[model samples]
Target: MQIPVINRSRHALPEYQTAHAAGLDVRANLAAPVTLGPLQRALIPTGLFLEIPVGYEMQVRPRSGLAYKHGIGLVNSPGTIDADYRGELQVLLVNLSDQAFVVQDGERIAQLVVARHEVVAWQPVEALSETGRGAGGYGSTGSA
Candidate 1:
């Protein structure tokens, strides 16, 4: 699926690193480095504006390498970008480690995944069908 995008940054547009990659890596569009102290978070801009099609949304996710190596992660994991939004794409990054982490210009900070969604209509009812494990929630099943 081809998407209409406007890139104002000097860096190239976000692309898949591998042939089978599900998400495209997005870079930071900063003039200078931004340092994030431990447990600190910042909204970093990507200088990218996209026009997502209706019935679809863009998901902003964290890079596994950055999270594993530097404890850098997205404050809102898998942030949803609605199809109607026509603003600059920004990532909410946080430092989970004790040391400070610096985000450089054109650095790959997050990823974007375009997915289709369905709008559900609520059917108000008093009773519902029963299940084998009714109301079973967190840790309801035995640990294997």
Candidate 2:
């Protein structure tokens, strides 16, 4: 699928990949770094903006290295970017570490994955069918 990327500023670098076969990584600008306290929040901006097509959504996920090395991760992990959103691409990041974290400009704070979604319409039903373990949840089945 063809995705439209908008570079608002001339200095903004186009979306690039860290590894040839790895997913594409988005970077921040050169002005300032988005800061997050021990438990505070920050909106990290991606210089390169995108226009996602309908019936598709972009998932803003944490970079594995950043999350594993540092306790910083997305506030709403796997945040969704709708197709109709036309504003700047910002990542809602929360620092769960004990120390304050600084999201440096041009740092790979998050990763975007485009996926297709279906809008399922609900229909009124009179009654529901039963299953083997009806209404059983949370370890109702065997763990092993």
- Which candidate wins on TM-score? 1
Note the residue pairs that clash in candidate 1. none
Per-residue alpha-carbon lDDT of candidate 2 for residues 1-144, written as tens digits (9 for 90 to 100): 788888764344444464552345666563776677798988866666778999999888887888888888888878988999988888788888888888786677777787899999998899889988777889987654
* TM-score, structure 1 vs. true: 0.96
Name the runs in model 2 displaced over 4 angstroms: 9-22, 142-144
lDDT, candidates in the order shown = 0.96, 0.76
The candidate that wins on lDDT is 1
TM-score for every candidate vs. truth? Answer: 0.96, 0.83
Per residue, candidate 1 scores C-alpha lDDT tens digits across 1-144 of 989999999999999999999999999999899999999999999999999999999999999999999999998899999999999999999999999999999999998999999999999999999987777888877543
lDDT of 1 at 29: 99
Residue pairs that clash (backbone atoms under 3 angstroms), model 2: none
Candidate 1 wrong stretches, greater than 4 Å: none
Clashes of 2: 0
